[model samples]
Target: MVTVAVTAVAAALVMTGCSGGPSSPATDNVAGTPSSGASSTSKSTPTPTPAVVDVTPADGATGVKPTAPVVVKVSSGSLSEVSVKDAQGKAVEGKLANGTWTSKARLAPSTAYTVSVTAAGSDGTPATTTSRFTTLKPAVTATYGILYAGQTVGVGMPASIQFDSAVTTPELRAQVEKLVTVTTSPKTEGHWGWLDNRQLMWRPKDYWQPGTKVTVNAPLTGVQTGDGKWIANDDSASFTVGSSMISTVDIKNHVMTVTRGGQVLRTIPISAGRPGPETETRSGTKVIIRKEGTVIMDSSTIGIKKGEPGYYKIKTQSAMRVTWTGEYLHSAPWSVGSQGSSNVSHGCVNMAPENAAWMYANSKAGDVVKFTGSSRVFQPSEGIGVWQYSYANWVKQSALA
Candidate 1:
């Protein structure tokens, strides 16, 4: 009976060890089985932070200036794309460089704009942002016009910009001048000078070479000229330099010599202005403003009355205007005998009928006319009198200088 009991107990111990009884459940754990008291837990990866974007003219902004910058930048990421559009869905030209996008063109006033941007984070997580803004409505809008547009002007003519509203302050004038672009073929050197409050002109260091091509672009729309005034329109002009026509008038010799391309064309007999306070022809460089056919000459335009000593109104022929103060080269049939001998007219070059017609026919606007032997001086403010100053002196008139 003792032997049977011992054998039975040994068999039971082996079964408990091999079969993994409740107290020995660790053995089942080695075989990839779960135990009652043990627990299973797993590790998970974390989500990445999103990219951030910043926009100028903040979202829903109103009354922004048209000159204000439209820009987009990204942080904690890289910019992928950017778009800026007007109310009509026309995209404004822009460029992206160094992770920033900037608009290249100026905006229109009183217009709505929308900006959209997309970016990706360091972990390639994408984010998008949008902005909307409206430009301010100017109280007064200014306009500008170009002189000598589409016309071949003389070599002495400067590219002129005339503003309807005066740009008074130097700070404002500099802003306007900076935006005016002058391009020339063969790359001529020039500078812009403010002739007056309303006129800005760009002239070459010397007379332009014949056949030189020039183009002026004034992107002045939205440019602020005053507290409440802004430029409403832009202006552009493309003109060319015509043949070099220069005429020299000798008041002492009483003769006018015309030259083209450095060759003499004509030596005309002329009677210059009589020697007096308001009647003597100005002695300096002058440019032809325009040609007037059969003008009704009146002394009153030059501040002389009918009964004044130098006052006389006559019907003239082939009148070419040279000064705003009423100086001209016109036909004086009455003084034909005195033309080559003496000066007899009142502040005008008195040429014979046929000679005056020849001059008028051959001349164009901005032809150079130099006078000698007169004591009266020509003021630079006169019509197209840019040659009155040396190149060094003229460059000082620039706002940038």
Candidate 2:
């Protein structure tokens, strides 16, 4: 009887545990019922967000030309910020819009640069990226060449430097000026005259001293000028002044005296125009640049009205060089009877053939040719004339001292 009773109670306990019914302790005490440990399920993990990537001007780039337009683009998210910086870490000026950024100016050559970018996703989570790049080495450049250096030529050969391109930067002008150093052999003072932006000329208050040496150097390579321009390469030139030749024309006395190294070579009587209208010759420093055995002298060519008192269509003889508009030191066969006696030619100092040839032989291109008279005011255009104004006045015309 006892075995049957024990078996029955054990069977009942097994049935209670197996059935989907509540346990006796959990059912009896609601607040303190034993909790199922597996009630909390595993939480779903959030998907990993994509990283932002910036493209363009890829990192470690070299031989990159300054002409390359800088541009930056982003992927995987909208761009929040983009910046370009030089090796010095200064932010390069640029613009950004529509997930794209660009720079207006080109980058400098052989320079290292860095770029940083930041982007954000739809969830407002932010991401950042960085890159570095370097430009290619600078190309071989060319510079201006001084054709005639340190040499005293005609005033026509203004100390001129022919540039490869029109200079556009103040820095370039400064650089070019620094390369030019002039010293007068006789210690005469001079200054550089910038005729135009591209053409720079140098001249002394007076003519360059005989035997003076001038040096010109144009070293403009790899120099940065504004607007992506630079000098081409390196060049140098030097020239020396020749013998001392000077001549004085006395329009009042109607004579021209030729000299060499302070020694009077000869004096020839001449004639100048009667003072009236523009025919009167002005007196100042001048230089003879041409000498012709004979030359056509058409009064009409020089604007002298036909039938005018001084107007005559004819060829003049023994014409020595005078660079002014219409003037010469020549033989006046028509006035030979008045040679050394009277002033009879039109604004020119007329002389005999022998005397004119002698002056031509002794004179050089840069030799001083001075004229003196009271008939006309010395103007700047009267031959290669410098006596119209004082040396101080000449210096004032130069853009640089």
Candidate 3:
């Protein structure tokens, strides 16, 4: 406080003697004298209230994730204002709830962002703070897309994607998966499940209905995967489902019957696995994944040594792969006599050249090739063999479910 006091005093004016020595004599200092028209006043200054503001992905942060949110909190008062923007002054969308503020928009890669916050304390005292940060720069970039030969897949077919680089972490994989959108024309529902870090596949709860249309969108240019891998560009694909064409092979009878829409189309002579375990074909519903004019058959690929009795490698024609365990339906001129007469093949379906060519030409990816009369069961991971598992069991493999 400051105080000012003045005294009021009435004094008479006295004329000094006309002495030449002193024209004006000095007057004594006023002591305990009152001054007229004097007043006193006092004033005090008020103290201010304390304010608080906290921000995360702290101020001056560098190499932050693009998906990282800008979070701000205020104490002793609710949030009054917040602004987040990029280097070009483009605003970053966000929302304020209670005393906290969060960024709604995903940040950009290799870009700088500035955030400012304002609030007030209990006594209306203003508070303000700011932060600047930069998102991590990508070192390598790649693209990815789904694969369905001829743009027509079977009901049992899974939507598969192959990435140029591996995405190992769950969080980073999820961020990349979010950029992928799948929509079906018939409105069927499905979910994506990661077979490995790099391979992703989606399938409906049950087999896709015949004639279903599928659309895939991967707007992934700025989407980041683990290990500094970012999407270089966007990708999209649309494919359709074909009629229900399925085939069943009975190893005991040495025959395979092809069917479509619950009607038998043809019954062809075929030779399945021999009785012994060393040459027994797995019995289960398997999807025909590929049909090439010629495929190099190798015994070592399935753990059979070169000197082993059943070991042999041959470039076979009209090859149609049914499983990853070296199982195929192809021409076997050498086994022509044994085909349909006896099961003499080493875990593969053997037929005459004309019959094999006819089957291969008509079959496409996702066509079912079920085998019976075998003791061994087909592994679900074997080439597109998604039908081996029951519908209830298949949904359990999905990551999103």
Which candidate tops TM-score? 1
* Selected candidate, larger lDDT, 1 vs 2: 1
* CA error at residue 216 for candidate 3, angstroms: 2.9
Q: Summarize candidate 3's per-residue lDDT along 284-334 as a digit string, tens digits.
A: 988887777798888888788799877888989999888767888999988
Query: Mind giving the per-residue lDDT tens digits that candidate 1 earns over 1-97?
Result: 0000001111222222133344664455575665445344555544454567788888888988878888887776788889999878978778999
Measured with C-alpha atoms, the lDDT of residue 341 in candidate 3 is 76
Better of 1 and 2 by TM-score: 1
lDDT of each: 0.84, 0.62, 0.76
TM-score of candidate 2 to 2 decimals: 0.52
Model 3 collision count: 6
Considering lDDT, where higher is better, how would the candidates rank from best to worst? 1, 3, 2
Model 2 spans > 4 angstroms off: 1-188, 194-201, 205-207, 216-238, 305-309
Q: For residue 254, what is the lDDT in candidate 3?
A: 92
Cα deviation of 77 in candidate 2 (Å)?
26
- What TM-scores do the predictions have? 0.80, 0.52, 0.67
Q: Residue pairs in steric clash, candidate 3?
A: 7-35, 8-34, 8-35, 8-36, 9-34, 9-35
Looking at model 2, residue 1 earns an lDDT score of 4
